[model samples]
Target: MIASTSASATIVEFTTSHGNFTVNLHDETTPITVSNFLKYINDGDYDNTVIHRVVPDFVMQAGGFEFTGNFPLTAIATDSTIQNEPVYSNVRGTIAMAKVSGNENSATSQWFVNVTDNSAGAPALDTTNGGFTVFGEIIAGMDNVDTITELSLCGTTPMPDYTAEQCSDSTFVPGTENFVTIETVTIIDSTVDTASSLNSVKNTLLSTATPVTPTPTPSSSSSGSIAWLGLFFTGLIALRRRFR
Candidate 1:
């Protein structure tokens, strides 16, 4: 019923058979990935789809294999594939786009979530598999993630239709006799109202952009001159203040 994910707090809720979980899409960081995923959401293509593949303690994936009509596997339709935007690491709870080997920009509909932190190796998943794009992150209902990950697999009984070569996680089942079903996925705009706070932030940024460099005062070696300069500036200040 779910696969996995984000930044502006676009909370995407996934109501599944096991339970409901929420993810916030990282719209600013991974724009291409988020836009692509949202296309599927807007089309309602992911609704009723089963969480077909589950690798215990690794990841739980969906959005590609659809179980319908006699409850069989049917290839889900997808729009044009999107470029890989793997900005975030494949850490636990982050959802990354799934793609075939060697094809970096082949990510279409399929996605996965890290049950465990898969961020290891020399370059790690950040530079591996054409960089799996992490577009969102689970914000709530981690219990549902646990429930999906710990589910029993079909083992040798349920192979879904595709050949072993085509699908890698074919043996995965959501649970015994029960597959996780994603009822619907909706986005929640949790954008912070910065209109009021921006005034302070703008002032801070302005101060940072240009520091207040103090004007150097003349030394006492020329006490008379220094006093005259100070008096002149004081008069100027008084005049300026009078204008105000």
Candidate 2:
């Protein structure tokens, strides 16, 4: 079921196939990006969407396509692309916008969550593609995000409900249950200001010195057991799409 959005919402909850999670928007710092995201939520543009791409240990992307009992997923209708607002660093649990390879302002409705710290490495998200716009961070249910990453992949797409047998079968046709669907995204709080309390160095990439990587702390939820697979950096680069 599609969720409704509140005009003054800052903390939003996402109920997905794996589980539920909440995010605190950096509305004060990235107002434009926040407003753009809220517009999609308000219009129900993200309803029943699939988390189409998952690069293990890197990111899980969604909000671009939907499956309506079809083989090939349909692209969600997008609004006009918003301007680049690369204010925050792309760290673990942070959500950012995805855009075309060479374009910085082409982001419309597609967004990805950084499963690991991709802020300062070779494919540093902070310095790549004019830096992916980090607009929100997970405040709860990150374990659900980690759990979604462990699902077997059918090509570049992640199949949340497919069994090991079905994933390997060539003739297997995925129905609505095969994808990690965002069942609903509703505003839960408007009073909390989690983004305001974030450390300056960790929140902003405008600093010259390398951002400090926070100690790996497991949040309260089901902990993922799969070891990090070989990092697929190219998968991050291929996310570039020329939205028309």
What range of 10 consecutive residues in model 2 has the weakest lDDT sum?
222-231
Candidate 1 lDDT (Cα, whole model)? 0.56
Task: Write the residue-wise lDDT of candidate 1 on 75-161 in tens digits.
Answer: 678777778776667777878887755566777888877766665432244455455677777878888888766654443112223
Off by over 4 Å in 1: 1-9, 156-177, 190-244
lDDT of 2 by residue, 1-244 (tens): 1122557567899999889989889877888888888889888888789887776777888888888775556778988888888888888999988876556677888888889988765446776556678988998999999988887776556775566666555466668887889988888877536677766335354445444332223221212211111112133222222211
Over 4 Å off, model 2: 1-6, 161-171, 192-194, 200-244
Superposition-based RMSD of candidate 2 using all C-alpha atoms, in angstroms? 8.9
Error of 1 at 46 (Å): 0.5
Work out the TM-score per prediction. 0.65, 0.78
TM-score attained by model 1: 0.65
Provide backbone clash counts, one per model.
10, 0
